[model samples]
Target: MNGPSLAIRQRSLGDLTAEFPLFPPLTRGCPKSSTDEIAYPLEVGYDYARVDPGLFDQTPGTDIARWSPLLPPLAAPTLGEGGTPLVEFEGIHFKDESRNPTWSHKDRLNRVTVSAALAAGAPGVVVASSGNHGASAAAYAARAGLRAIVLTSADSPPAVQAFARAYGARVVSVPAEARWPLLREVVDRLGYHPVSNQTVTHTGHPFGPEGYKTIAYELFLQLGQAPAAVFTPTGYAELLYGVWKGFVELKLLGLTGTTPRMFACEPAADGPHARALATGAPAAIVETFPSAAYGIAGPVGGHRGVLAVRDSGGEAVLVTDEEMRLAQRDLAGQGLWQELSGAAGVAGYRKLRREFGGPVVCVGTSSGFKDLGVGAQTYPVLEHPTLDDLRA
Candidate 1:
């Protein structure tokens, strides 16, 4: 069956109009050839036949026009996810994902994840996330008319819980150690499509990266040229892989002549990916000590972290919680509110500011609400309803 016709929408960033890349059909070796089955290069167990890469990209236009085509036909109720602002700061451009539908970059991944579920004939989708990814999956699944089951850390923010519940997803609270296994059971027993990291090597769903490639496609159109570099906050390094893959594909398609250097900013509390990159190992597993940037805190499962750093000519830099916190506060002063994980890109840039010579883009991965419950909380309460008392 021919899939639904994709909407080719144009987005206007200032005076420049760019089209989102058309979604190409899935084929062996990432080509649209006469292959009977979709073959992926990921070294893991994946039913490649169930995924279609076409739902990932569309011609860029306004946020509506660009993402409208990326959504399913008869899909309605848009909340403005895709066209996040590409903010410029100190010769660096940043994709402020604080503006995404649920205030995180996970929206991009879910847009395609839900589409894949539809193509695969799955009844629902499941993912385990501390914050953004589960919330985004829940939102998109609701839009796709599919059920969503989110297995998340019980310690996650109330905002994240509210968002998932708001979308009608069944939120299963579990200890962090039990999340992945329970998610696996749900996927196996109920046949829900799993969107979380599954491999010991960090290789996520074969089709999920297709959604992330749109970031590079957007960068190319928005700047009218590729920047000198693109930086991302790294947890499992999925976003890093997605952006690099997109640029590599673009270069292959003859749409771009040069690829930008990619960099990953990782929290020092769990810098396994950085350690792996530094040691030339297949993958690095660190004894993680959690920090304020809970979004990017975890033991990286596989070697994709090494792969992302090596392939993109990227270096992984470690940022302390204090550094990320300062970066968060600085960004908020600019009217860009982001979570600690979301601000890691800026932290990376600040660390290498002396070395960076030209245009750079750092991805601010999510809104600050995801981390509001991370530490001590205090709020002043008004004892009396008086304007003068409030002002005082």
Candidate 2:
């Protein structure tokens, strides 16, 4: 049986025109694109022609290992990362990634990134993240028996901070602009592996996004076919691009006849991915404002996202904080407690207000517990009263 990696070489996302050896993992952007001042990430190429179609016959089990042929070299143990459910709430289908091991879709990405760490014989892994990304990386690193370090913004959710620390990561809070530089130092001076971006733009670990492709494979199995369109919360757009790439691989394997229009949902305060898509640039950098949906809020945009939207003929949708609040409440009423940023997909769909020819899927990126103010709300409780109190 073909094991967890069929990856042969790394290909530049700039034009899918350049290739490099898969070893010495490219955590930063491709050299060609980096010289151009735009960080175009690399995608791991696989021998897809040799893949067995029977692999897709069954659902992925505890982790993403079931789709090993399409993934990069995974050297870590499974922590029950994949196998999330697709639940239909109200009118749209939600992929429900909060069910993942770390309670966020980022587990899928870190599963492979951490494997890259282990494969490289690194002592540990380091990342600069304020929320879900940090927490997921810590959990996966712990599972892989690697030391983890998480650099977060000062205002990162306390619950998330505790979550990462509980996983034995050395968690630190720094100024928003200081994380990446510190992380590079940790990688260079300390010789720890870096799982997050260390570029002018958001070019993350090449192998990690390959983990996200499993979502598309799982969705295809769940829906029995590809949905018409998929709306995903977008920050760096790695999740969006990875999901689109999964479907692209499926098509390349001669499985799916059609591909879904990939929608990139961003915070209205700072829609870098949306702006980049509209402007037709390879990537963009935009000024940001405060938004509660911080998980999907970013200043610099990555070319991977622009490629996903443009390639899929999909449009980027921007939603406001108020809109996300409504969407979050809506999902809560229906028994899914997603983070504010997690609800951006549904918010984007509603903002579009356009029905598709077939089913549309919305991705819920993380659990409500990962929100910036998870424990802040105070709900009034009734004192012991009687039937009258109940009636009132």
Leading candidate by TM-score: 2
TM-scores for the candidates: 0.80, 0.97
Clashing pairs in 2: none
The models' CA-based lDDT, in order, is: 0.70, 0.90
* Clash count, one per candidate: 19, 0
Deviation in Å, model 2, residue 71 alpha carbon:
0.8
Q: How close is candidate 1 to the true structure, as a TM-score?
A: 0.80
Q: What root-mean-square deviation over C-alphas does model 2 reach?
A: 1.4
Per-residue CA lDDT of candidate 2, range 1-392, in tens? Answer: 24656789999988567899998888887987576568889989988878888888896566888787888777888889888888897777999999999999999999999998998999999999999999999999999899999999888889999999999999999998899889999999998999999998888898878999999999999999999999999999999999999999989998999999999999989888878878888888899998999898878889889999999999989899999999999999988999999999999999987878888999999999988876989987887868998897
RMSD of 1: 8.6
Residue 33 CA error for candidate 1 (Å)?
A: 24
> Candidate 1 on 124-162: residue-level lDDT in tens?
989888789999999989988899999887788887888
